[model samples]
Target: MMAFEFPGQYYEVIRGTLRDVHAETAYLADWLAKSGKATGGRVLDLGCGTGTTLRALAARGHGGVGVDASAAFIAWATEAGGDGLEYVRADLADLDVAEFATEEPFDLVVCLFATLNMVPPEALVPLLRQVRGRLAPGGHLVLDAAHLLGFVDTYQPSMIAHHQRDGVLLTRMVHTSVNGHTACWRNEETILARDPDGAVSMHENGFDQWVLTAPQIRGALAAAGFRVVAEHGGFRDAPPPPFGKGPLVQVAALDG
Candidate 1:
C-alpha cells in the first residue's frame, strides 16, 4: 500500500472518481442554489479539485470558472467543461480575481471538501481575503471543510475502491504527527483494461492533508473580513453528531 498526495495528477484522479458522490452533490446543490439567484452572474470554484462543483453549478444555469493550483486538474477541467464553464490554472493566492470575475463580482465562491484544512491557517487568510474582495456586496463565500469530528474513526488497515474505470487501494499508514495537523494518504491505483492489448499500469502515490477544526475555519473566515452566516453540520439534512464519520462542515459568510 502506498500513500498519495493532491494538487497534481492524483488530484485529477480523485476528482474524477469522486465527482458525483451523493453527499458531495448534496453539498454542491446547497451552495449553488444560494449563488445561482444572481441572474447570470459568475461563480468561482476556488481550490477546485477538478471542477466537479463548477460543472454541477453550470448544469444549474450558472456560469462558472474553476481555479486551482493543479495543472493536470486544470487541463482535465478545460477538456471536460463547456462554454459558460471553463477552468483556469492559477494559484488561489495569486489570481487577479478582479480581472477574472466576469460579472464584476462573484455571487458565490465555493471551496469544497476540506480544501481549506490542507493549507496553513495563516495562508488561508490572504487567499480568502482576496476572494472576499471579489464578491459583490452581500455575496457569499461557502467552503466545505472537515469537521473536527470527522476523524472519529480509528485508522483502518486499508480500503479497496473498484469502479468500471479504475481499481484503487487506499492505505492510511503514515500519520503526520506534525502538530497533528495532517493525515498522509498512501494509495496504489491501476487503470482498468481499456485496450485490446496490455496498456494499463499500476501507480503508487503519497500525499498529505492538514486538518482544521470548525472553530478555526470560522475564525479564519472572520479574520479575512467575512461575516459568518450559517454552518450546517453535514449534508444529511440533520446536524452532525458531536463526533462522527465523514463529517463535513459548511461555512457560509458574507463580505463585511
Candidate 2:
C-alpha cells in the first residue's frame, strides 16, 4: 500500500473546512434506517475515519466498531466515545476480525466514501472475502465506489481547488488518468494555518488512488461469496443508475 502522507492534518483540515461531518452522519443514518438495517445490532464500519459513522450508529442504539489504518484517526475517534462504541487501529487489507469481533458477528459492515477505491487491485477481493467471513448470517455489506462513467468518461485533467475556514487555507491539486480498465487519481495538497498573532504554519502531502468499474467491483463481491441485494447511484435509496451515470453503492448479503 502506498503511504498516506499527512493523514492527520488532512483529516483535521477537511473536517473543519470541506466536510459537514454532522450532515454526513445523519444522512448515512437515514439511509440505514430506510433500508431496515438500523436495528441495534453489531456493526462494523470498515475504513471508518475518525469514527464519524460509528458515533451516529451508536446513537441509533447499535453496537459499533470503527476500524481504520491511521492511528491518528483512531486516536481522534476514541475521544468521541459513546456507549456500545469502540475504535480499532489497523489496516483493513490485513484485518483479523477475530481480534476485534471475537464474540459476535456484525449485522452490517460498511465501507463508504469511496474507501474501496484505495485497496490495491490484487488485494480487493481478498479483503472482501475477509469481510464476508466476519458477517453474521443474513448480514449485509454496504460499499461505495467511484463510478467509471463519472470517473473515466468524464475524466478531467489536473486542476486546483482551494478551501478556507477558521483561518486555515487548504489548496488541493488533483490529476486524473485512465489506463485501460483502471482509473488513477493523484492528489497533492498544501495547508496553511494562520494564528491570531499572524504566525503561519504550512504542511504538504499527497496520495494516489486507484479505482475500478461497477461491474468489476460487483464481480469481486460475488467472488467473495456475496450476493448483491440492492445497488444505487450516489447515496439516495433510488434505483441504481445506468453504468457511468454516477457514483455507485452496493448492498450485498453473504451467499447461500
Candidate 3:
C-alpha cells in the first residue's frame, strides 16, 4: 500500500495538468443537485486529496468535510479551508465518523478518483458499512473505480506518462497484472526539479493498487446495506460500457 503524501511542490506541478477545476466541480455539483443532495447539506469526501471537491462544494453553500490519510495533504487543505469547510487528517478506513462529523449524518458521501480501490478486500465492506451508518436518511454514496475490463481486456505490460511545468517535470510508469479477481497495479513516479540557480533535483516514489470488478464493488455495496440507484461509465450519467471496459461509477442509497 503506497501512502499518499503529495507535497506542495508536487501539487503545484499537477494542479494544471488535471481537468479544468470549474468544469469538473460544476459537473459534480450538478450530480448532487439532481440526486436531491445539494444545498445546505453536508458532504463527506473520503480520500479527499487536498480537499478540492470539498472546498468547491463548500463555496456553493454546502457544508463539507474532507478526510485523507496524509498529514501533508490535510495541512494544505486546512490552510486553504474556510467558508463551511473543514479538513481532517485520518484514514477513511480507520476514522470514527462520530468524532469528526462537524455535521453528523452527511447528506452525501463521495469516494472519487478510484479512492475506494485503496481499501483492501477484507476491509472494503466494513468501510462501506461504516459509511452507511454515517449517512442521513435518503443520503447517497457516490463512488467510482477503474473498471476491471480495462485491466482484463486492454491489458498492458507497462505505460509511461509525464507532465512538466514551472521548472518541474513529473514522469510516471505503471505496470499492471491480474490474478483471479484482483488486479495488481505497480506505479512509480519521478519528479525532477530545477532551481533558479540551475540546480536540479530528483525525487522518486512508488505505490500499488489492487482493483476489483464492477460487479464485485456493487455486491460489496449491497452487502453493506446499500441499494444501487444508478450506475454510469464515468463521471457523466452515460450508460456503462460492456463489462471489462471503461471506468465504473455507482450511486447508491442506504437500504431501509
Best by TM-score: 3
- lDDT per residue (tens digit) for residues 15-60 in model 1: 5565545566555556545655634646788777667666666766
User: How well is each residue in 95-116 modelled by candidate 3, as lDDT tens digits?
Assistant: 7777774546788889987778
| Candidate with better TM-score, 1 vs 3 | 3
- Among all candidates shown, the one with the greatest lDDT: 3
Evaluated at residue 141, the lDDT of candidate 3 is 88
In order of appearance, the predictions have TM-scores of: 0.74, 0.82, 0.85
Spell out the clash pairs found in candidate 3.
149-244, 149-245
Quality of model 1 by C-alpha lDDT: 0.60
Clashes of 1: 12
- The deviation in Å at residue 253 for candidate 1 is 2.5
Give the lDDT ranking, best first.
Answer: 3, 2, 1
Better of 1 and 3 by lDDT: 3
Residue 89 in model 1: lDDT: 71
